[model samples]
Target: MRLTSSLLGIFLALAALSNLRQASAEVGDDEGVSFFIPSGHDTATNEDVYDLLRCARALRDEGTKSDGASKAVASAIAAAVATLPPIQLAHTDHTLHQVPERARAYLPAAIDLLARIRSFAIAPPCLDRPGIPTTTAGPYKYLIAANLVNCEAIMPYWILEVLRLGLLLSGNSMVLAGFSQNVANAQGSASADGYLPHISVYESGSKDNTVPWLLVAEQLWGAAGMRTFVVVNGSLTRQMVTDPFSGKYHKQHRIQFLASVRNAALEPLYGAPPGTYDNVVFVNDVFFCAADLFRLTHLKADIACGLDFEVWVGHKKGHMSGITQRNFDQRRRRRRLQSSSGASNAADASTADLTLHTSINQMSDVHLDELVRQMAAEGRIRNAPVKIKYNFYDTWVSRDISGKQFVSDVPYISDRRTRDILSKGMPVPVKCCWNGAVIINAAPLVNGLRFRSGISEKGECDSSECSLLCQDYRRVGATRVVVDPSVRVAYVPWSKSFHGSLSVGVGPRVPWSQVQRSGALQELEAIWNDTKRDMATDCIPLGTRSEEADLEKVRSVDLRLVNYTQMFLEDRRQPSQQPTVPRLCNLLMGPYGVVDYGTAFDDLRFAALGKNTITALTYTANSTVNSLQFTYGSGSGNVTATVHGRPFGNHSSVVFQPGEHITHGVVYYDSDGVIKLVLTTNKQRNTTIGGRTFSTNMLESGKIHQAVATPCPNDLAYAGRFRLIAIAGTSDIRIRSISFLWTKIGGKV
Candidate 1:
């Protein structure tokens, strides 16, 4: 419900008069959601405040007849205040309706509950605010209700949220359950620990010792049971194009370069056989622990991101080369709390890189167990209706399902329709999001849903390359995207508690199992509506080389808009349900050289995958092509082993010169499982292949490999031809399934 004036007045008035606030720190207040009830308001006495709070609690608990949450909260407040007519005589316009005759009997029980709530807090909300409830004396389950909004009113609202957590004990059963805990020693997010996750960390031109630290993390993570891939100083800006005629080099567009780097980070997964890793996590330069990755990996969204926070880490003193360090002082830390709720365009993230990355490492320490324990204990998270000290960071890459930027920085996103659901501090649904970090289901990316820059010159939205990735996810029927507020991150490593709460909530909005979804085609159609829609709930142009390009009205999205429009408006029926077009595979089987071996072509991603080149070759032949072992780059380095046909043929290797790459070749095999091989290079040089082979030629399945073509990539070459890049086929002795892998070659005039 829209906040009423009186309710707002109550919030303002109570905040001014509240005695719970401490001098240096805040406790029970969530953003503006205050838990300390005002004992006195305007002229109300100390006794009067308690009585009103008690009455309201009773009314709420009694479930007094009301329409919904907003109405119910209003009714409870009205009923409570109605008792003291002299105090709130001018207020409580909140509910015109009176308390129902059926509900006013449980006032005594509420009074008792109020006494219990005050038992732990020694003083006020800020300093003496409540801490995690412990059951050291015996079994105790506290009645945990949290402020899910930012209204510090006399009639403060509360939601039955778990601080989104319950503490999990390691070996013993003495568990002190809660969400936001400064008292207990945190361990892990119960379910996320133990499983060894292959971690991929990306680092670039940061003015800090990030590379050396990541190298340290590589070893530490392995000790902590994790397979880590650390890319240090692997900046994408060096990917240059040398003009053939001018002999001069050209740099790629910022957006194009960024997309290439992100893809490079996922190179291992993309080239690996299907299902190499369960989840591919991408983390930015933020102060985070292993617990953070474990917790984020456990998130439920197909594309899940953590809520990021900022603390003034540093400043740019000079031109990146010479810089003086900023003192880690209280003043700097306090600046974190000064950020207002506002929108940040992609420009913010671009400029954010200027700040010196925090020197100390944040990735090595916390294990999965520690993070698990922390989330389980903290029954809540930041960014809800609570006062999150750090304003929500990383807004540049996030867009709600309505395709608009997140309107609020904390207390959950203030999107009207999705607010209530998000307020519970769960994994909230969104169209796209990439806060400081993200965990994506590797399957879709493995299939070939890649990040790409926009063709602003061609009337397409020059939005963050990330935006198109989400669209690609939707296009390929992998459309479960969301941002999990439960996983919190900060830029500075000053205060662990100040980093914000960690809890996935007791019950996730989306569970842990996979569910079949036919993508959000309808929602996408609405979001990408180029005409007849409010600009607010539409895609915003970002990543431009010039201000003028950003201002241009986007006429289309994909350069191959015709193909996209075809896919977008393709008969809305599922692959099984559609009756019109024949199965794409049926048409692709022979001409496309689709080898039907054991579990061949089972991975749906292969239908729209990239290419691969032949690496190592080992074939045994008597009458036909027998045993095979071609060590091609399949992301996971799956070496082809002799399964059925094996005579241990003499192995031979093909070594290409520096910059030399395979272009296209023919593999002619017969029914008796025989073959002859012919491989050609991009320089018109064909290696000796013994003979022209026996029979059938597996024609180019080029259409399948080059599905999402980029017609106007910024890094275009005036003259270039396709050469080998990656290959697809079984790692076993399936000689029939060797497909191609191609990428662009040297440029021309």
Candidate 2:
């Protein structure tokens, strides 16, 4: 809320500098080419047209050397200009590739046609909309057209388009969005360009939120490297579930900080800075981490100017408000639910609903929490690192055959809700036509708080519609919600850590000289189970209140949850140990053992200790060499192997087990070159690799591993250590007789 006068001075000075850059227009400077079209009216003169023409020429020339995608964009622009009626330029719906058939051929000739337009010197700056001024004024009036027909908001659309094109050509798929009207240069320093800003953020209709964007200018004053900025309107308030900053300060501050943090992470590309390389983040303590930005960011631009005269064409309709609002509400509600549940807030259950309906009710809850949510001023002190995962599915088909019967008659609606919601604001839904699109939204249910949508009779649902209704009933700062066309949700599993673990075994195992039917493969499986079972027993039980303080701290900070489940797999493929007499085998297997270890399974029977419960994990590997196998059997029946089929190959695969513990089983190992296994578990508070500590469930339990009874504690034996097991038959063979190493020998058992 407080800003230094010196900072303010810097802001004003930057504004002036930007204004001066355009001062050439008044002085009859006609050297630059313009991208804008000029007005023929008497108020507009040839001088303006000339300036615009110069700017356009300059831009075209800039792109002249562009290759691949960039060249394609420029060529498309050129082609569109040559054949499409000048009036057709007003149609917002037309992308460069969507021009008339005759215009298609003109694309190759576009560059030359554009060059001619630039020659006019008095050409008008291209006008995308009315009112907003272009970078330079002239034939291309410098006005930006909205994304919708007859709309007037400018700047965002044009800037975004340019950035989008640049990104395409650069091959950076990461969607970098800008906010506000300031331009941060390639050197990281920022300066206000022009006030052609359509986005206005007001704390209380007094101070503009745009002031914070200037923070980038100050922070990057002397830094170097690519600086990105994104400006979006729909206030980044708590009302919209997609807001990255929905805490105390304001959405503006949150986005500013988000950008700064992301820039810091990306700065590695520019080389590290001097000391500590703090690379100060200007978020004002609101948003933190790139994950937040990635999860909540949204992009929108006005498009009316492009379709000014094409109103009659349904294809050129604006974004629908009904659909937009619906999507916004649903997203906001989900956010509240996630925050409350993740943070374990003690607020009354009804408070979430009240928050959800804040805007609709026009109620005020501007307390610190509410303020933080609205202005995006909250710090990392009250947030969690939210993990978002995206899943893609065909709308016409369901994974379940039962759901398929209703697909045709059900009017499958993947983005129909988005259409319905946006219908309130725009003339049409831009999303209805997309397939293979990615839809990003809040996770379905967070803790007890959830954002549930109304299901249709045929099991169809409309998230956009439900969101709109919910948001319409709430009172918050944001006007509308942001919904990603991408069909990905911010996934927050009931369990934070994953069970899939990779163990890297380094010790030696049985060799293939002395042969048996099953060989040492069974022993290999036992060692793996010993490592896993020990890990499971030693971990804190799920849902227990152990280490509450540590958990609180984790919850309060935005630290990413680490899952070191692949270390074992990577360690196996590491360069082979120097071959030696008694060889690597002497180091792994016990002294008098001739173990022919291959692969084996196990179903170790164990009882739950203290509060600890049984945790089942399956290990998989792929290589030319053999490893171990595990199986369980009783006095009355055949021993059942804990694992099924071969686990390791080329692709990722999941290992499944019935429960935490089984009746009886055994394990075996081969000690061959291969040891790449994907092990998954269901035991709460139990996650480890080769018996080494990786991650433990937040819950607390008092269980200890059965391996602890041995001299080599499970923790110490599996701690980044594994053995190579070789299997021959049902017997164990020592490595003393084998001549070949693991990788050199490959054959199917």
Candidate 3:
């Protein structure tokens, strides 16, 4: 009789009455058969037991088409049936007694077999034939690989959305590997629309009850044509401890563990035969969408990456929520307190404030003005709202002594200029990009490119694995390593408080009709429009030049010497045993000045000069002096002289012995109007001025003299002249010849 309603009922009743001892004896008599009732038979309903028996009978009745494969299938089916509860107590309700653990023990193998059958039945014809191009049918097939650790909460929400988006954008040609850690039972299922994502879960050293959830995932995904693989590694003998304060368990060797798991997820693609897939998209724990994936793929580079963005914690409004009213209020209060307390913390405060402001500006938030006003109550900012003046994270690689090397993050201003040069919708070359969400061409992998786990040959740390891999790819002639700015993505930070909310306050949101009418949305739209217009109009060409070209251009030229002259003052002999007064002449020259004068001889045959005697020579016109030259009198012995309050020439005091003589001095004016004095003497001598001794050298030998004095401030353009002062310290000084030359002396030019 067919195992239908009435026949199944009679069979179940007869089996329930039969003794377990008798059934065991009867199965023992059959040499190749072993049958024993499960322990929890009393808990199972009659129908459940009958169904298990019917499945086994059907498998046994089917003739062995292929001896090897059919025997394996029959053994698997028999094993599954043997684990079911006994039919004797099947009619009893399962509420009072623990049901048998047959389903969990046997369902994996059974489901795997069923999945393989379904794959064989529905898979594309190209899948069975080696050397056939799968891309010929549609878009290039992609393998999205990721490693998950206890991500059950996010599986149905964020992760599922990622899978859905990937499939939608790339068609059914996409495959996903959701490798789980200590979450084998976490429930997830494939879509009912016949799109199955491959799920491989490993449970290690975890006591959490994840099996039920994982089974649900298997059922759902399996029905949707997905192949799911699960492994429960309960062999870990280490004691699991939870922190008393945070109530979270510490994960030992987190980095190594994660790396191993990620490697495991990549194993399938790594071992796949050639031409299996065109790309392998390695997605980390970040939020992204289909458009981001599509944009990254469009670049078609060896490695195309997306920009990493951040979101504020506890802010669930939108992408603009990072800089909310609350942030503005807090910043304003802090600034006000700092101002009242006379604290020099403006710089620190502004840095913190700018971070939020820039995020708001980038997101095109509508409330930027209101936020700015709230923060800048004292009109701290005069013009536009604050923005990130430079890029703090994104960077570029440039050629260094060691070939292409990673440099500091590129400044935002510089990146903006680069963007303008390349224009929008272009992938900019980079040495390496964040591996969080990148589409990598399979060719690199085929050529043996792999991520580094330890120090690389270039001495880079494990963290630089992406950079090193890209470098290797370049070495192999795959130089297209780029970042597509158009493929923008928001980072979803791990948060203990985050539930399964569709909106995690990051990236663009779905534009529901109701959402479109909101004031914030309207403001955001307006801001975006204004930003686009401003960007279009304000963008300027970078006009970059090479170092050689820059060196080839002339910066400035020195002023040429235009005039030179010398003068001698009239000799004055003392009359009536009295000292004669020295006369000074004002020099008259255009932009250049040159003059020379000699000391006068007194009538007594000795020149009488008081200490600190001053003489001035005024110019005919007021003009900026670029440079000046002066020569001290060689006849003046051990005298201290100054021009415009600075030591004349190099020495603070022009010291000379009875036989020694003074030499020429010079004063130079820089373009900024600062003056410096340099001097040379006829002989080397030790002289002390301002408590410092210096050895003077003769100018005739081209030796330098030391100058000790404060810089004298003289606006030659306004003052119209300079001074010459001579300090005679306890000696009769005879002045000799003096000369002066000036060049490029004119109004501020």
Candidate 4:
């Protein structure tokens, strides 16, 4: 019997369908079936074919169990499968030849099947039930999501590591949603990088072959009792279109597009009820170890992020440097510059032109202006140069003037400090951190906080997205956001050779490799081990009492007399050749003023000794003068006082017998911008100041009196300088010793 070509085709398809059905029946629900794709074929490609067969078997089983709509949907899947080449003939080489024609027909049929399934609103029986928690024996359940773009070479390794750490080692339930775009072939020979294998054969006029690997990931994750979701948006390569507004062709490559894809992956979390998962881990292009994942989830902060270090690729460090480090470097450079030259400290200096740039390189002009304005308000230069200084002695005493300490904003210092703090199992407060490897509390999402991609009110672009999200978290009253330095991660470059270079290897050329193996890696391992051991220990309190106690103890020690003598010695040695003075004396005369021992010469000039002034140190308004003790003797006339260029007549006046010691106490702005002066003497005396009667008490009992004159401009709310005028009304007055304790009352010093 002679059969028509069409009849022959139908007969072949029917026979293949029968065999497929029999194979499906032999395989149980829990068992997965493998496919024959020839040895030496790409392992990834073979895995892809195996995944397709599994999907076909699942659809075939669904067809057998249902009626009407379900049956029709299953039949559509079968029809799509039948049109494709037979599984045994689906070798990489054969698929390469047949993909053009077969994919054209198979793709539409597959889409039709998917469309019908969607219309029926029925999920395949193999999938977990929605809103129903699957019983897992793991310690914690996590939903991990990542966005990929042409990352086939690394995806396999990354996914495997995540599963190994999240499920196997840590015993945690994991659900992954991998999103990709423009990661497939666009009609070219596959590159020799082993990234997208068999790409030339599978290029069905589509730029994305991401489906294959995603399918393999889903299968592997599913076999381990976890769920996986893949969202592919095809190629985002340069597809030019005429702009509606400009009427000119422009490529559509905006961050908004990528942000939209990310938001889509987050859709499941949005639809799910509150508390659907314990945490949502969003991973970017990073090569992380198992401990990193465990540490991130264990942190349990509102948003816990990890530190992403630079991976040396081709002998050059990649762009994964820590954000804290970058900011710290900028701050350090600025500080050095400010201490060097007066020109660099000018208020008009441009902060935007600072040497060290942050991750967000191009700050908006308005933001830059605001930064400059803030620096000016604080009397700081944007970017100043540092002048190198030399000292002979090393006896400088560190003083805590205002009882308040601040963290250095330098990246190296801050990063080291943060690492040290976290190494001790303490969480430190941070302004912001990169979200490269972060485990976010789902409550923030459930309450409507999302990753923003628009310009903020401060004109900050999307580059500041992480910072903006942190601000939003703070606004919503979420818990603190911190970076766990113990959770170390590295960035993965496209070149496998670069990754290999940094791995275990012995060579002088690759010093980092040797360092990594000998020192860095071991230290990291130690930290990881320590973190795991201390996981159950409570974190050190946010603000410990020990620090405050230390401050109080330091304040109690009276270093005034010692600091005064040092200042006097330094003054005497300044004019001598090869003069020797204690380093402590030089430090006291440096940035923070301790004391300026006055001379008895015709023009006795004492330079200002404070952070703010050249003659008399300046303090913010509402400051407290704890105590003031000094010994002096006047031969004849009264001593006058001037503060910030304003005079206080006879308020600092004193009367002394030729050898009598006198002490005076003065508080600026004591009552509504009025100065209070207290005089103590061995003998009681009456003095007149601005025609007001002022009396002195015994040397033991201090007398307090208001100054007859104001020392600052009436309109000025803040005082800037203070000066002591020792005018011998008749003869010279000698100052023996001076000491005082003061601190800015409530403002930052």
Candidate 5:
């Protein structure tokens, strides 16, 4: 019910003047909602004010009875107050319509409860003034209600938030019990610990080594009314262990220990104070995340001081990096367990399981085709993308197997045929001809992208022969020396061509030295002598006769040499061998041949170029490829395995690469003959039954090992059952992947 101001005013005025408070306290004084009641205005005396409180309270209790009863109660109160001599009276508005009738009885009870509440109150010089500061035990504004009342108003406004901040600020903590001791310890400890005064009762630990844990504790303790009834949420303990990476001990632990030692050494100078603690602090050693600790803080603060406080031990600047660190270590440890236990062998796995893989070459088609069909039959292909990379040239080359056109403008590619090839029950060797045998001139093209093109020439350079020499230009239809497109595919630039030279054209089909000039040679020799006589002449100038005659004989010999060169050129030639295509087997199966390590579990992330990468083993079936499976567990003990996917009729082994990001599952097989899988992260890890960590370098070569058998609850054909256990002291642990194989004809391996 809503309280009317008139009734509130009567109680407030009466409470202000009543025996429940001195002459200056306020409303509900006896109820522990506030400090000393307002006893009076300046003119009011102690007894005079008591009468007002008594009268107001009576009016409140009478509320509104039946007409006769109400009149009778009101008459009685009026009669009692009227007996006193007239004084300047603060009015109590007694309008019964606004007051609830049920409130009528509480007036007497308030008086009775008043004496009990008085037990908690201190003797006062309390009413100094409004807005005056007060100590924890004083009648200060915030402390007014706090000092007299049970914790109500103070908790909602400030206490809880403070404790939450404290826990985060200070990792160390101490929980003390009871009211009297808590107060005694707070008063004494404040003076003894100077820099880091123990705030007492509640706070989060600060990671800052410089901020003494005591200072935070002192602030928290001092804020409560010098004494609060606190319950033991937990004890302060040193984190004795060191983080291997940091190589540092817990700094807060050392400080706390020293403080405790000092407190023990020094005794309080004053008499026995309220809340003096015995065995007040102790060292605690356990590691838990700040997020986890926050919950504890809330629970504890609510009880102490009636304030709701939240504690977070390792949270800093609103971030929980410590929790994240713990999670990461868990995943790494789990992977280690899978590898050492040989949990990935699929051939030995008994139940149906689906495994995934990344990229596999052409030979993989033999098994992958069946694997996909089996996966589909099991209805497990929820999300798989068909990835395609078109090598245009492969299609170009294979367009016409009949060799109709030796070369086509269109590029050959491994396109539609790729789907067709992979779709078959068996894998086909890739066609190895121009596309596979010849290496495309990619280097020059790449270089061209980087290089700036030279400026184009305006005109061709002058040259006598266009065919023989690379003249700067050539006429249309003029045969010129150039690289052939077909030959360019097989050759790098600046190498020897199919035939030696572009030109072979110094032939005059001479019928055996026709015009073998003996006489013309003599006459011509004489003229040659005359011609040689004039050398270095713009206009023909003749040299001296003796030197001229010798030059003439040399000139005649030079002409004879030029005449015999054409005859030798016509006599030389060699036949060139024709080109042929290469066989398919040599190209499809690489130099050492391909090994299909059957599919392990994967998300097919390998298909994407610039995303999370996937690495796994590729498996191919030699004969009728059949069933595949694997198992895994979370702990080193016997793991419960469950199978997924459909079993094939032919034998197949599950393959997986250990260090890859995606292929994590149970050890390929469990004794139950089911494929097991688990979840794991960085913080909580799996160790081998012997406790060995898995390292990346050790898995260079693959191993297909045997699995140890354990009992199954029931004979199961698929992922029928599994087990999970709670870690004793930690919150980090899970499983990731598994691999194994089961064959029908063979005894279990």
Candidate 6:
């Protein structure tokens, strides 16, 4: 894709615009983004106009790559981009009636242009982008805008595009979300105000296409009539350290540079004018989107945030398929414009997919990009909620409101009140959080606050710059900082979709009150009454560092489980003879293998929770829990028993007392599957199952979560909350995993 004569001319003009913008040497070479007002001479000539239109025509190829109606489009507009304009014209009105034939060319474009913009130098930017949603609930009756958009610590360009589309799409999403939030706005359908963020990037020591892509993005944004600033501190030296004139650092310099890179991203905010922008969103190298930007902007807090997750499969090339199954609750979704008809707010929930194709785990960039695009087009990535699976990666930066650090496992928020609030889909207050992305009010920063290093003299631990920003926020009376559990992000785009990603509404803030039931609010007295505070490690400890590289042995999840098994052993009655038994809803858990994408029988429930007293447990074990069967006691006594795995090896039964039940249990196994299981009863009765002999590798295994209730990936229960029932794992001959299902006997936690 070499630059043509026209595109080469665009390069020259774009280079000129770049020079006019804060130049390469405009700031300290050591750090900081180039932030400066555009000059009067930053205008394109008539030649560059044609090149833009040509590039746009090329980009908007709807099907197999071919030239679109570029010539006609260029002819239609009389030098629209050749010269700058003074007064911008208004677009079409919000009407249920049909649009007039005359105004069709720029009806929606004008509408978007009038909101939060003067002009894109000559015309609205990026006409090649997917057209704006034709119909909406109404118009932009409310004004929601962010003049500054911030990004830091980036990797590949595909991940970057996810955010780019997010910032670009925020213009309309904010308006739509706003109208939905305000009763008057939706009713009035008043067309006014929108979003247009000045995207800024700060990168350091990257050996990839990030900088080139960013440079091109600047050109694209400039054509859109928006401002962009990019600064890449790329240097050839990898091992160069020992403070060489503040220019290059790495390795031993890794710890020092582990930091400065973050602070560098904040440099642009330092010299901005007060009230210039409503919010400044700071995102790390995590996957995010336009929906993310829209959700973060609407939160009622001084700082609103989203968390990140990381997952990797120990995959070897074996025709491994995509995620077999994941489910979600049904809800109203704003689908794109229907054919001829307006956009429909489709109502249906798509199960969030972890579609990191195991077979293609080591795929090339182009192939991966194709997969990413295909999956991204589906509903899976758009509305999936966030939840911790193995590790909540940002433990160091994320802290409870009381400044206590979170755990390293799933359901990371340990504070019951905080967890309850988060579980209820509210923005729970936090001392600080930088899980992945955060939307912050730059009013304090514009006033004096800065993202800086820790001060040892102030007793602050050497922590992230985000912690320091929160500390400054507290000092400036901007302490309503919270993390929305719905807004989820991950290191890989194929990972979890953010939490709080739904039809954007201005939901109430973290409601602190009396907690007696579900969605109960916690009391805010402790937060309000106490005043004195100090910077400590408990609140701002170390940044999260995942051990996937070192602790690879403990990490094992069967990505091949394809059967979406949901069944019941009995419908509160034995089908063969008994009148009534427990209504058991069994589900699949752990790395349990599924066969042929179908369950063995119609009444199959793989992983189920029950408090029923197991009168007897039988097993045929060679080494692992090879084949197992169990019977529960009732008024009629032990009636029928259920069996899992093969009926081979030495058989034995461990009977329980009258009132004994499994309080908690532990399963020890490996790639060979369920090797052994020990159920701990309420009366300290321990029933051990499986063979006495096993290897060392299987000993150091993961635990089956005790507080797990829901089958949904995003929703999880708490520890000591749900009791284990009957585990119906081992569907296939090669059952390689087992996890304790910790759910209530009859309901979800």
Off by over 4 Å in 4: 1-141, 165-209, 234-243, 249-253, 313-419, 422-428, 456-462, 493-749
For 401-502, candidate 4 gives per-residue lDDT tens digits of 111122211122223424344333233334345435776677776666555433323223222234345444544555345554344455432211211212
Instruction: Report the Cα lDDT for candidate 5.
Output: 0.20
Against the true structure, what is every candidate's RMSD? 22.0, 30.4, 33.9, 29.9, 45.1, 27.8
Cα distance off (Å), candidate 6, residue 651: 88
Q: Which residue runs does candidate 3 get wrong by more than 4 Å?
A: 1-138, 169-221, 226-258, 312-417, 421-426, 456-462, 493-749
lDDT of 1 by residue, 409-457 (tens): 4443545555544555445667678776676776766654556665445
Instruction: Score candidate 6 by TM-score against the native.
Output: 0.41
From the highest TM-score down, the ranking of the candidates is 6, 1, 4, 3, 2, 5
Give the per-residue lDDT of model 3 (tens digit) for 666-719. 332211121223333335432222222223333223232222211121223423
What lDDT tens digits, residue by residue, belong to model 5 across residues 1-749? 12244653465344323332221122222222111111111121233223333433333334343554443332222211211111011111121121234323322222221211111111111111111011121111110001011221112112322332222222211111011122223221121111111222321223331122222222223321122222121122222422222334332222222222222212121112433321111111111111112222221110101000111112211111121111112243234323321232222111112111110111122122222222221121111122111112222212111111112222221234222222221111121122212111112111111111111132111111110011111111111111111111110101111111211211111111121222322432343233332211011111322211122221111112221212211211111111121331110100010001111221111111112212222222221111222233222322222121223232333322332222112232111112222322122343121112333443232221122211121234312222111110000001111221111211111
Query: 464, model 5: CA deviation in Å?
Result: 99
Q: TM-score for each prediction?
A: 0.41, 0.18, 0.32, 0.33, 0.14, 0.41
Question: TM-score of model 4 relative to the true fold?
Answer: 0.33
Give the C-alpha miss distance for residue 341 in model 2, angstroms: 39
| Global lDDT scores for all candidate models | 0.36, 0.21, 0.30, 0.30, 0.20, 0.38
Ranking by lDDT: 6, 1, 4, 3, 2, 5
Task: Show the lowest summed lDDT stretch of 10 residues, model 6.
Answer: 328-337
Taking the tens digit of each residue's C-alpha lDDT, what string does model 6 give over 1-749? 11133543354345444433233232222111101111111122233233333333222221112222322221111112111111111110122112223322322222221110111111111111111222221211111211112222222232223323332333432223222322123321122113345666655455444454444444444333334555554221123222212323333222233333443455455435555565666666555443444455544457778666554222211111222211111011101111101111111001111111210111111122222222332222222232123235677667776566655554566666567555555556777787777777767656645454454344444455566566657655676677765555565433222222221221222212112232322333344234225333253333334311122222221111211111111211111111121334233334342211111210112221242445667777766566666676566556344455456677888777776656556555433345667777667787777656544443333322112222332333432334455443322222234433445544542
- Going through the candidates in the order shown, the clash numbers are 54, 212, 27, 10, 116, 14
